[model samples]
Target: MRPFKSVPKARRGDRVAVISPAFAAPAISPAIHEQALRRLSESTGLIPVEYPTTRQLGASAEARAADIEAAFADPGIRAVMATIGGDDQVTVIPHIDPSIIAANPKPFLGYSDNTNLHNLLWNLGVPSFYGGSTQIHLGAGPGVDDIHLRSLRAALLEGGSIELTQTSESEDFGIPWEDPRALTSFGNREATEAWEWAGPRKAVTARTWGGCIEVIDEIAMAGRMPPLADLEGVILLLESSEELPSALAVKRWLRSLGERGLLQAAAGVLVARPPVSELSAPVPSAGERAALRHEQRDAILGQMALYNPQAVVCVGVPFGHTRPQWIIPHGGSITLDGTSRTVIADYAG
Candidate 1:
C-alpha cells in the first residue's frame, strides 16, 4: 500500500463535489439535498458542486464510480461529500478504480453505508474523514451541530486538535425526510450520558480505522481489509447506523473482529454514541428501546474481555448516526487518553 498521506483541506473558495456513491436519497429528498447544499456554502464558505449521477435514482454502480473518479480527478474539487447513505454501496466498490483515486487523493466524507468509500480510501493510503454526510449534518436545519462544525473545520480547514466531547443532547429518531419540515429540524433532543471508558488507564495515539460497525461486517466478510498486521496500532472507531442492530448482532460482529484478529490488532477502540432508534425500521417497545444502548455497550466490553482485554475502549463519542457528529479523519491521528476519558484528534498532521 502507498504510505498514508493527508488529503489537502478544502479552502473557503474551493469547490467540493457532492456525490451519492451509495444510495441516491438525494433524488428522493431533493428539498433536503438543496438545504444541504445551501448549508455547505453558508457554513464552510466552500462551493458545492454536483455530478451527473449525484441526484440520479438507481444510478448504476459504474455511474457512481465515475462520479467518484471525477470528484478526485478534478483538481478544482478539493473535497467530496455524500448526500446520504444507502445499503448497496458494497456493489459500487468493485467498480471504483483505486489507481485513479490514489493518484488524485482528496478528502472524502460520509458514514453509514458510505463506509465502503472510506475503506477504499484508507486501503489506498489516503486520509479521508469518517463523518459529515451532507444531508445528515449539513442539512441539519436547526443549523449544524457545533461539535460537528468544530471537527469539520479542524479536518477540512483549520487542522488542529479537535477534542471529542459527549454531546450534551442527542436524537436518534427523526421525522420522515420526505416532509420538507424534516429538513427544518431533527425532531427532538434528549440528554445523553458522558463517555464510558473501560480498560487500562493509559494513553495511545494512532491512525484511526473502522466506521459504521455494521458496514465493517460487510467489509470483513468480503475480505476487503488488509492483513491483520497492517492494522496494528490503529484505533478502531465503531458505530451503528440508523438500523439500530441488536446487542446480539453487535456482539456477533465483534466476535468476528476477534476471530479475524482485529480486536487485538488495534491499539485502542472508540465507539460512537449508539443510535438507540431507527426511524425506517421497526420500533421496539419503549422499555426495550431504552435498554438497547446499555446492552450494546456491555456487549462490546464483554467481547473485548473475551478477545482483547488490554484494548483501551471508550463508548459514547459523537461520531455517527447521531446529530452533532464529529468529522473524524479516517486514517488520521487521534489520542485516546484513558485517564481523562477524552479523545483529542490531531487533524493537522
Candidate 2:
C-alpha cells in the first residue's frame, strides 16, 4: 500500500537488461530482434544486454524468473526491458523473488502479459512502465513510430510531465514472424479520433495502475491482486489485446473490477485505443468496425458509471495493443485535467 518508488532514469552507456519474461517470438524473428538491438543502441546510446532466455523458445518459468532476478541484481544494469509480451507470464510470478526486485528497484518497461510484472512491482512498492516492447516499438519496421519513440525516450532518459497525444495514424495488424515477406510490413493504419473525456471538469493527478484487460481479469480470477488500499488515488489504465474481446466481455470485466472496488478507488481512468479488427477475426467492413468500437467504448463508460459515477474517464488515448503507443508509467503520477481534457503523466525527468 506504500507509494511506489520510481527508478533512476537510463543514461548514455548505461546497461539495460533485455529479458523475455513472456513470449519468446524473438527466437524465431532473430532478424527483427537484432535490428531492434541495433536501433536501441543507436537511438538511446545505451547497451542492450540480453539474458539467457531473452531469445530462447519454450523457456521455463523458473528460467525467466532467474533472469529477472539477475537483471535487478546486476548493479551495472540501470533498467530492464521485456523483448515482448506473451499470455502466460502469470506462471512466472510465483517464482519471482520480491525482495530481489524490491531491493534493486530499477525501472522495468513492457506491456501485455508483462502486466503480471507491473502488478508484482507495484505490490513491491516499485514503479514500472506499461509500454515499450523491443519488437513492437524499437523494431517497428524501418523506422520507429514517433509517438512511441518520444514517450519511450522521455520515460527512459528523463523524468517529467508527458502529454498523451492521439496519433493521426496507428496500426494493430501483426505480421507473422515465420513468413519471409512478413518482415516487409503487414499492418495498415488510419487517422485516429480525438480522446473523449466525461464527468466533472476537474483535474486529478495520481499514480497509475491497471493494464491489458484480459491479463488483469486473469490476475483477479487467480486472487493475486494487491491490497485495495494500495490502489486508492491511483490512475487506472486499461486496454484490450489483439484478441479484441467482445463488447459484452469488456463490460463484464470492468463490472467485475467495480465489484471488487478497484474502479471506485482510483482517481481517474484512461482507456487505451482498442483493436477493433485483428488477423484472427474476420475483417469487418469499415462501418461495422467503427460501430463496434463505439459500442465497446459506450459499454466501458456505462460500466464505470454503474460502479463509480464520479470517476473521470477518458477514452481512445493511444496505448495498449495499438501502434504509436505511449509508454505509461505504472504507479507513477498521472494528471487528468477534465477542464483541459488532457491526460498527462509526470513519467520522466
Candidate 3:
C-alpha cells in the first residue's frame, strides 16, 4: 500500500471544483444545484466552479475522467466536491490519469457510487473525504444540517483531530427538486441512538478506508479493488444506500469480505446509519423502520464476530445516507478508541 498524502486545506474565496464523477442529478434539479452553490458560498465563502459534464446526463466515462483531470490540473481549484453519486464510476477508473491526480493532490469529497473514485484515490496515495454531496447534503431542503456543516468546515478549512459525534436527532427523508413543494420540508426527525461498539477495549489508530457497501461490492466483483495487503491495519467504514438491502444480504457481503481476507486485516470498523426509504417506496411507519434498523445492525455485528473477532467495530455513526451526514477523511488517520467509544479523525494540519 502507498502512503496517503494530505491535501492542503481550502481557504475562503478559493475556487473549488464541483464535478459529477457518477450520475449528474444536477441536470434534472437545477434549482437544488443552484441552491447548493449558494450554500457553498454562504457557508464557506468559497466559489464553486462547475465542470463541463457536471450537469450533463449520459456523460461517458472518458468525459467524466476529463473533468476530473481538468479540476485537479487547474491551479486555481483548491478542492473538488461531487454534485451527487451514481452507479458505474468504476468505469471512469481506467481513463483517469494517476500522474495528474498524484501531482496535484487536493481534497475530494463525496459518498455512494463515488466510492470507486475514493478507493482509487486511496490507492494513488491521496486522502479523500467519503461524505458531503453538494446536492444531497448541502442543498437539503430549506437549509443544510448542522452536523454536516460542522464536519465539512472542519475537514475543509480547519485541520485538526475532529471527534465524530452522533446527532441528537436525524432524518433521511428528502424533498423532490422538481416539485415546487420539494423546497418545502416534508419529514420529521427522531432521537439518535448511541453508537454501538464491539471487541476488546483497545486503541487502534489507522488510515480510514471503505465506502457504500453496494459500491464496494461492485468494485470487488469487477476485480478493481486494491490488493488485500493494501487494506491491512486500515479502519473500514461502510454504509448502505436508500435501496436498503435486507439484513441477510448485508451479512453475505460482510461474509464475502471475510472470505476474501479483507475484514480480518482492518484495525477498526465504523458503520453509518442506513437509509430505509427510497424514491419508489414511501417511508415506513416509525415502529417498523426502527425494528428493521435493529435487525440490520445485528446482522452486521454477527458477521464481524465470526470473521474478525479481534477487530474493533462501531455502528449507527451519522455518516452515510442519513441527514446530518459527516464528511470522513478517506485514507486519513482515524483513531478508534474502544474504551471511550469515540471515533476521531486526524486530518492533516
Candidate 4:
C-alpha cells in the first residue's frame, strides 16, 4: 500500500466545499442546515461552498461523486465536508476517481457512512478526518462542542498535536432537527466513564486507519479494503453507528476482521464510545446504556485477546456517533500509550 500524505490546511477566508455525498440531510431540515453553514463560517473563518447535489434529495450516485470530484478538482476549495452521514454511501464509492483526489489532496471531514470515502482516500494515500457532520454537530446542537471545534481547527487551519480528553458528559442522540429547541438546546446528556485500556502496557504510535465497523464490513465485502500487510503497525479506529448494533453483532464484525488478519496486523486499537440509543427509539435506562457500552467493550477486548493480545487497546474515547466528538485523523498519526493510557492525535499528518 502507498503511504498516505498530508493535505494542505485551509487558511482563514479560504473556501471549503460542503458536499452531501451520502444523504441530503440539508433537504430534510434546511433551517438547521443553513444555521450549520453560518456556524461553520463563523467558527472557522473558511467560506462554505455548496454544490448542486449537496442539498438534492435522492441524488444519483454519479451526481454525488461528481460533486466530490469537482470539490477536489477545484484548487480554490481547500477542504471538503459532508453534511451528515447516511446509509448507502457505499454505492457512491465506485463513481469517484481516486486519481482526482490523489492529484489534489485536501482535508475531507466526515464519519459514519462517510467511512467509505475515508477508505477510498486511505487507499489513494491521502489523509482525512474521521468526524464532523454539519447537520449533526454544527446545526442541531445549541453550540459546537469545545473539543470538536478545537479538533476541527487542528484538522483544517492549525497543524498541531492534541491529547484526546474526555468531556465528562456525552449524549447518544440529540433532539430531532425539526424541533425548534434542537438549535438552542443540547440533548439529554449524562456523565461518562473513563476509557478502558487493555493489552500490553506499551505505547504504539502510527498512522491511524479504520472507522465505523459497519461501514468497514461493507468495504471489505466490496473488496476495497487495503491489504493486511498495509495495516501492519497502524492504530485501528473502530466504532459503531446509531443503528446501535448489539454486542453480539459487534463481536461478529470484529471477529470477521480478526479472521482476515486485520486485528493481528495492527499495533494498537482505539474504539470510540458506541451510542446506546437513538432518536427514533425509546431511551434506554441509564444502567442499560452503561451495560450496553460494557458489553461492546468486552466483546472488542475478547476478540482482540484472541487475535492480537500484544496490541495495545483502549475503548470509549468519544469520536464516532456521539456528542462532544473529537475529529481525529483517518490516515494520520495517533499515539496510543497503554502505560499512561493517553491518546494523542497529530493533525499535521
Candidate 5:
C-alpha cells in the first residue's frame, strides 16, 4: 500500500552470496565465474560466497529457492547476486519464502531472468536492483564499464543520485563464455546513436519498476506481479532480453502492459536498447542492426502514444541484456526529465 523500503547498504569487505536461482551458468563456465568472483573482490572489496546449488547443474526449483532463502536468511550475507540469467527463474519464484526474504532484506543485483525475483521483492515492499549479473557484467572485461560500475557502486555502497548517461558505443553480441579468453576482453562495440527522449518536458521523479519485458510478461501472466495500484506514478524501466525478439513481439508485450493499465499508471518509461542479434544468429550488418533498434523504439513509442500519451518516454537506456549494463533499483526513486533529456537514479545506499 505504501512505498517499498531499501535494505541497509553492504559495506566494503562484506560477504555477498552468489546464487544460481535460474540456470547454473557457473557449472557451465566455472572459469568465467571464478573471474567474476575476482572482480567482485578485487574491484569492489566484497567477498563472494557460493551456495551448494550455485554451480550445480539441473538444480531443482525447490533447491534453488532454498539457496535463495539461505542467502537472505544468513545475517552474515550482506548482499545477494546471480551468477548469470537463464530462462526459468519464473519457475523458482513460487518456491521463495517471502517471510524470510522480507525479514532479512538485502541488496539484490541481477537482471534478465532474475527480473522475476525483483518483481517478487517489489510485491513484498522490498527494493531490489535490476542489473549486475556476475557472469554477464563482471566477467566481460577490458574492465567493467565505467557507467556500469558507477551505478553498481552507488546502488551497493553510496546512496544518492547517479546521473544516467548514454553509452557512446555498445556491443551487439559477445564471445562464448565457455572460452577462457572471453573474460579477458569485453564484447566488441561500435558507435551508437544518442539516447532519445520524448513526451512532456515536465520532469517526473517517482519510484522505478519493470524489467526484462519477457520476464515481466511471464510473471504477470502467472498473476505474480504486484498489484496494478502499486505502480501509481512509477517510472517503468523496461528492456527486452537477449532473445532478440521480433519488433512485433516487442509491440505485443508493451501493448499488454498498456491493456493491463500498467502503462497508464506510469509517469515515465525508460526502454533499454534492443539487442540486435543473438549468439546463434548470423551477425547483422551495422545498418540492419540500427534499423532493428529503431523499429523497436518506434513500436514502443507508438504504444505509449496510443495508451499513455501523458507519460514521459525515453528510449535506448543501456540496462538490459546489452553490454555495459547499468544497475537500476526496482521500486526506488528516479527522475525522468524529458525536456532535459536526462535520467537520475536515487541509490539510497
Candidate 6:
C-alpha cells in the first residue's frame, strides 16, 4: 500500500475553509448554506471560512482553483470542504497548484465530483474524507444525521476507528431546496436492507481509494488515475451519483476499471448504496427501487468475479448519494472483514 499522510486534527476554535470547487449549490440556496455553516460550527466548534468563489455560480475553473489554492496555502485553515458536488470539477482540477497542497496538507471533506480532488490528494500522499457535503448533508436536512456527525467528527476533530453501521432508514435525495420543508423535513425514506457480501469469507484491511465512479471515468479519460500497481492490496470505494445510470452503464464503468487491471489490483471492494430516483424524475415504486439496487449489485459482483474472485466485496453501505451518509476515509484505512460481515474506518489524527 502507498504511504498516505494523515493531517493534524483541528482544534475546536480553529478555522476551516468552505469552498465550492464544483457547482455553487450555495449560490442557489443561501438559506441552506447558512444553516449548514451554523450547524457545522455548532457541531464541531470550528469556524467555517468561505473563499471568494464559494457562492459564485459559473465561476471560471481558474477562479475555483484559486480558492482551493488559497485555502490550502493559508496556515490558519485546518481543513477544506466542498459545498456540494457538481458535473465539471474535472476542469477545476488542472488549475490547482499541486505544490500548495503538498506544502500545507490538510484534511479535505467531500465526495462525488470532489473525487477528482481526492485522487489528486491521494497521489500527493495526503489523506481525505469521502462523504461530507456542506449543502446536502449539513444544510438541507432536519439536522445532521447522527452517523454523519460521528464520522465527520472522526475525520475533523476526533480521531479513531468507528464501525460503519447501517442506518435503519435511508433516503436517496432530500426535498427540493426551494421547499420550506427542505429545511425541517427529510425526503421520502424507506427501510434499508442489509449489505450484501461476496467473495472469500476472510478479512482484508488496507488504505482506501476510488470514489464516485462517474468522476473516476472522467479522471481516467484525462489520464489522472494512479497507476494500477499503486492500488495493490487497497480497498476500492465505488459509488454512483444522482444521475441514476442504468445497470448496463455501471457494468461498463466497472468493466473498464477491471480491464485496466484496477479490480484485480485491489484486495477488497466497497460499494455504496446508490440513488435510484432523481428529483426531476418520477419516483420509483418500492419494488422498482429494490430491483434497481439489486441489478447494480449483481453487475458489480459479476465484474469482480471475472477480475479477482478472491477479493472481498461488500455492496450497499450508505456513503454516496444517500442520506445518513458516512464520511469515510479516502486515502486512509478501512477494514473489510468479510468473515465478520463488518466494515470499520480509521480516522487518523
Candidate 3: TM-score? Answer: 0.96
> Model 1 — which ten-residue stretch has the worst lDDT?
1-10
For model 2, the superposed segments whose C-alpha errors exceed 4 Å read 179-186
TM-score each candidate.
0.96, 0.96, 0.96, 0.99, 0.97, 0.99
Name the TM-score of candidate 2.
0.96
Q: What tens digits encode model 1's per-residue C-alpha lDDT throughout 107-143?
A: 8888889888888888888888888888778775667
Off by over 4 Å in 1: 280-287
The sequence of per-residue lDDT tens digits that candidate 3 reaches over residues 221-303 is: 88888888889998999899888899899989999999999889998898998877666676788887887788889988998
Cα lDDT tens digits, model 2, 1-91, are 4866658898999999999999986897898888889888888899999999999999999999999999999999999999999989999
TM-score of 1: 0.96
Looking at model 2, residue 259 earns an lDDT score of 88
Candidate 5 local Cα displacement, residue 304, angstroms:
0.3
Worst 10 residues of 2 by lDDT: 177-186
**Backbone clashes in model 3, listed as residue pairs:** none
User: How would you order the candidates by lDDT, starting with the best?
Assistant: 6, 4, 3, 5, 2, 1
Global lDDT of each candidate: 0.84, 0.86, 0.87, 0.94, 0.86, 0.94
Better of 3 and 6 by TM-score: 6
Pairwise lDDT winner, candidates 1 and 4? 4
lDDT over C-alpha atoms for residue 298 of model 2: 94
